[model samples]
Target: MKFISWNVNGLRACLKKGFLDFYQEQKPDFCCLQETKMEQGQADIDLGEGMLEYWNSAEKKGYSGTAVFTPHQPLSVRYGMGKEEHDHEGRLITLEYEKFYLVCCYTPNSQNELKRLDYRMEWEDALREYLMELDKTKPVIYCGDLNVAHREIDLKNPKTNRMNAGFTDQEREKMTTLLSSGFTDTFRFLYPDLEGVYSWWSYRFSARKNNAGWRIDYFIISDRLQNAIKRAEILTQVEGSDHCPVLLELDI
Candidate 1:
């Protein structure tokens, strides 16, 4: 089955820019969306028939949010990690299928001034614990805007972006910790030698035009699911948001 993930920046705006067209073109078995920046009742999106849509909207309208669209119904669905404060932002949504758990998350950003770095670290710890607990029960297929460029190969100019929020040492280390705990970065597994491949780009400084971008969005699966991953891709040509779509195809 094919699974896809993308941070649409804003669902409303993205729709106008051909979100539906891309969705129809890909026709993935499952699709996870992050940074929707919309709340229930604010806008209506028709995804057509035969697809189940689940949304977790932040309490703050037009902020952080996530949604999952699946052709196969999940056995159960969960929102967040049961943390009252963290749940407010609608950062996480997990769909428990018979075989594996699919988690879509919009990780908290450290912001431009680095004022939220402490909180971001706390989130990292909590999220890691949550994923580990879930992994104990079943293998996981996690995706979305993880908001960190894991290594020097993940971004165009890692040296210049070292102190940046998404490239900070602390943030990257958290990603390392997650990967060390039996999760595989699917894209890297497929294209270890590929360069200048990125999923997200800045609107400022003509970043995308110059191919200055970061591979922040990801499709990470448990180590046990590594062999199941048939293909992993970054659809850089698909435009609508600052971030592009990441695709993963699994035999299961």
Candidate 2:
């Protein structure tokens, strides 16, 4: 199966900037989007005749949201981690398939000056527990904009970005804990030493033009799916939002 995850920043705005063109070209088995910032029916999105869309839009309009588009119908669909505190953001969606569970999430950002670090930490713990429980039932394909640079090699200016929102030790360690607990970061698993490639860039200071960006988006699978990984790539050339698409191909 071919899976694609991207943080469109804002789906409505992205549609105006060739989002449909790129979607048509890839035609992935599963397309997951983060930060959609809009509700279902707010846009005229027609990926194709049979493609089904499952959207989790924030109660607050024009804010954090997620959506999944696929031709396959899931056996069951779940919104959120079943935690009241975390369920309000529309940041998570789980689709239970015959063989695996597909989870798309937009992790909470720590925010400037670590204003939300406490909440972010709470979210990480809840998410980890949620994923672990799902893994017990079947292998999982979890993909989305996790919003943290796991290692120094994941960003251009690691030293300067050390304590920033996405690069803080607290955030990075949470990612480390996730990977250590039976999940595999597919891209790093495929190309351990690969560098200079990223999925997200800031609009300021010519970040994208200078290739100064961070690999915050990811396709993390249950450790059992490691052997099924066929292709993992960061589609740097694709443009629409600040983030480019990340692709993962599995032989399952």
Candidate 3:
């Protein structure tokens, strides 16, 4: 199966910026989107035919949200982690298939001066526990804009960006803990020595033009799924949002 995940920034705005064209060209079996910022039916989306759409939009209008488009119907669909504190943002969606659980998440940013760092830490811990529990039933394919640079090599200038919202040691340590607890970061597992490849670029300071980006988006899976990883890549050339899509292909 093929999977593509991108933080479209805003689906409504992205539609006007060639989102449809890119969708048609990629034709992934499943397309997961984050930061949609709009509720379902708010925009008319014609993603060709045979695609089922599932959305989890925030209670607040025009805010954090996630959507998934796929040709295959899931056995069950779950919205959020069932925790009131974390469920309000509409940040997560889990699709259960016979063989695996597919989770698309839009992780919260720690915010300027780490104002939301405490909440973000709570979210990270909760999400990790959720993923691990799900893994016991089926291998999990967790993908989205997780909003953290896991290691120094993941960003353009780690030294200068340390303690920033997405590059803080606290956030990075959480990611490390999750990976250590029986999950695999597919792209890194496949290309351990690769560098300078990133999925998200800051819109400021000509970050994209200068290729100063961060690999915050990811396609992570249960450790047991490592052998099934056929391909993993950060589609840096694709444009529409600040984040480019990350691709993962598995021979399941």
Clashing residue pairs in candidate 2 are none
lDDT of 2 by residue, 88-134 (tens): 88999999999999999999998988999999999999999999999
The lowest-lDDT stretch of 10 consecutive residues in candidate 1 is 39-48
> What's the TM-score of every candidate structure?
0.98, 0.99, 0.99
The candidates, ranked best first by TM-score, are: 2, 3, 1
Candidate order by lDDT, decreasing, is 2, 3, 1
User: RMSD to native for every prediction?
Assistant: 1.0, 0.6, 0.6
Between prediction 1 and prediction 2, the one with superior TM-score is: 2
For candidate 1, give the lDDT of residue 73. Answer: 89
Clashes of each: 0, 0, 0
Cα error of candidate 1 at position 138, Å: 0.9
lDDT of each: 0.93, 0.96, 0.96
- What lDDT would candidate 1 get against the real structure? 0.93
List residue ranges in candidate 2 displaced over 4 A.
none
